[model samples]
Target: MNILQAKVLKSCLNSEEKVLYLPGNLSQFQMALILAESSKFNSFIFANKYETLARDYVNKNSSSKVKFFLTETSVADFLPIIDKVVVFFGAVTPFIINSFGKIILTCLRTRTPLYEVPHGLFQTGQNLVDNSRLINTDSFYDGVGENLPSLTNVKLSWYGENGFGYPRTVLKDAYPARVIPKFTLVTSNTNWFLYSLSDKRMFYKVLFDYAKRNSDEIFIWCPHPAELLPNTLSHSVIEFRPSNLLLYGLHNDIYFYNIESTDDLIPYCEYGISTVSTCLLDYEMHSKRVNIFNCAGVKNLIAAFNHASAFNSSKEISHNAKIINTGMLKNFDALKFDQLLSQEVSKENFIDYNYLAAYV
Candidate 1:
């Protein structure tokens, strides 16, 4: 074994190695197949260790004999115990990149074949490898899927299974919010900063503050799946729902809102708000509102307000919203803001001003 492989193996002690790989966490039902394979292979799937949905799916579907280990287990600890490795998803994420690299080297030294599923081995860009190590990778997703013998015979193809598959809903029974709306906002913790990159956590903190100010409105601050730990759900204005179905169950008038990353919540919000998020594209299929937050500097204030109020300022804001240019500040210079949020702040720190202070 190479030096890196040797190091990884030594840390694994003497346990037999078994591993599985997953491209994405959405394939929760696939755990049955993985667990079945585990009994013969001593394997584990490569995925985010902290993802709640993935773990929950496994726990509910897997037999008691199957062992589910998190990705946090060190390569050294995992390599020695795994007898076979199967990757489940298209490889992405920093954790997967590092862990998979170590595994690749070790497998090369050990002469173990790493099995890849359909679409599991494709690299969309040159980022996956350096020029020297490019030849070994394979992609099942790239094979020509449709063959057309003539102009009339040509068929257009797309990704994902679009059959009339049954939709799975998460069931939760809990006290409903005081005021439920036809449409509500749903944001996750992972992209919390996306609302306002300048002030950290301003996205959520500000939103909570706004909700408190407008407690009469039936606004829901549905926590991201991973953000609903016991400690994270403390808020007064918004009703917290652990299951998206329960949140969706409340009303059909509900609309999903996200700032940037919607890797997980895209499907839940069939009607979406489009801006920077790719998930918004999926929502466009329903022709939902795709309002853009026009003001640039107030990203922090806007994020906080959206999170707390459970209402997007964009709903009230428009391209023609009043604007005033304040003279320059010390370092960042003068700024402009919506009359609603900017009316109170000096030009110098308009963006820096706290929206929560108004709610508190």
Candidate 2:
């Protein structure tokens, strides 16, 4: 830990009130900010040494009252001060398990409340094996169980039953409804597609072709924050990096809206396109029509939507555009959304505070 970081944590340790520890990624940071503004807990936003983008994002989005910290701070330094720990992606990477896992362990030892907040929507059992490979289990602390330390003794926001032992909390729809645009293309990074697809470039080609065929429609392409377009794909298709385009800004030609999470922009889009991404599930929840490109076959994608009854009710838009309609979900009520957001965490169904501490 850096000397300056230690000093920062030491200065903030005066409060006995619970501290909500959150990773500093744009998604997690946004979630933390929402929770902090609505709840009474003080938040500590942790940024990895290399996450310059994340740090900048938090600075821009967070208010003056929000606290920021370097992830290098010692777990021992946090143990005494932190009464509650909230993790976004749990043990998905070695850096995560090492940096954030220590704080979770500390919370466990101290019997502090620990909550596992999901950063993505499609975290079903089908992808657990693929996601778990990112963890370096060999480095786990002594006496830890075979399961990832972060998964044990934590409250989870799960959509379906897949057999993880943690207690589930139904995630109330938080996104507000907006006027649906003509068309939107949601892009994910090749890093994830490369895992299950043969030729990632082919995926982009198909996507570009789809966009070009529908050039007449007012089209908006929202690429993943880390998305890298392949050289083979037409450069003309993607107008600008999402950061360069103004937020919710309009363009006469094909537009690339500058935004962070696709979930944030989904409400404004009418028809959407993407491969098997969690955001598609979110779009379904919002009743937005989405086309799941079958570059990796539809088997996995079909299984993902198995729990969603609305999936079967969707009509096909094209051979590729599996236009799923999620109208089955309750209509978005602005008052209800606000109520859910501001409702006290105590009222929600969470893992027993005692069980969360010692279950592992």
Candidate 3:
């Protein structure tokens, strides 16, 4: 509102090559901070939508790297200051296309450098930046993930991710990236509870089987956040390890820990296994060998691509790992899948980034 601040804010949006971010959720906001930290040009973000979240992320984890601006009216008026438009999308649901399409379509109309950051691990399909009128800018990817492929005109581009599960804007020196010599990280996912995939996708079962083969390694069972809920049928399985360690590690077979966050243990894990969890991407990035239980993510990516050229800039997902993606929907029911997907897109959980004076 001050004269000096207004000038700077206007300059940020008007300046060439400056990216204005519209993050729909905390994940998107955090990702924007990471990108801003790396960008040679300054990054501008809407202050009205997430000033509180912005300030909180900066106070806790990020340094002062991003500029926040508030528009008296819709910031859409100051389009000239924006060099590029970027949004983070995981799945291309109808809800998402509606919520974010406004700014994206606007930028495309002007032939601006419109880029989309598909934050999901695989980010399969066409990528993002789906423009009908013109060839949109390439979609930026952080890591490999299983997500809905973007529409045509959206190309995959590499921006590379430093790390997730941490604060944005600034990198902390405390959590150094180093792998444990003989530790295997096992992740819990929703599929584990399903009887169909239980035999193959079960975390404890796979760990036990894998442990039997490699006695030298310690398998750590880091359950997903929702797994421990007492209401679930698997509550009895929770042995209540107060000490949070030692699951008959006689030959270092298995070690179970009930921790709130796996941010610390994740990096130390040399090997990892998961089915559809986002952490699998992190494991693939940091771990030596990552064993994914299901090949759905891999299969989808292959189906989306014409050939192997898309994998050229991929930092994770290499041939060294045990990545086998068969594009067949073996046990998948097409009708059931379509119904579920339709329901999900129709439900509309898309968080809108609108102006709010709730900054702390």
What CA RMSD would you report for each candidate? 21.3, 9.8, 13.9
lDDT string, candidate 2, 1-360, tens digits: 111233335453365455565654655565565554444555555555435654665557644445556555644565577666666755445555555655655555555655665555433222343324343343311111234334433435433332221111123354454444555655454445223334345555555555456556554555554443354222433552233222233533343345445566666676666655556555665566666645333345445563322121123224344445422223223333233323344422344333433322
**Candidate 1 deviant stretches above 4 angstroms:** 1-19, 23-44, 47-55, 62-101, 107-180, 186-271, 281-289, 292-360
Worst 10 residues of 1 by lDDT: 148-157
Q: TM-scores of the models, in the given order? A: 0.32, 0.56, 0.47
What overall lDDT goes with each candidate model? Answer: 0.33, 0.47, 0.44
lDDT for 341 in candidate 3 is: 19
Off by over 4 Å in 3: 1-14, 24-27, 46-51, 59-63, 69-80, 90-92, 95-101, 108-111, 126-156, 159-185, 188-265, 268-271, 276-281, 284-291, 294-360
Model 3, position 186: C-alpha lDDT score:
59
Model 2: runs farther than 4 Å from truth? 1-17, 40-43, 47-79, 97-113, 124-127, 130-152, 160-182, 193-199, 229-260, 295-298, 304-360
Best by lDDT: 2
Give model 2's TM-score versus the native structure: 0.56
- Lowest summed lDDT over 10 consecutive residues: which window, candidate 2? 162-171
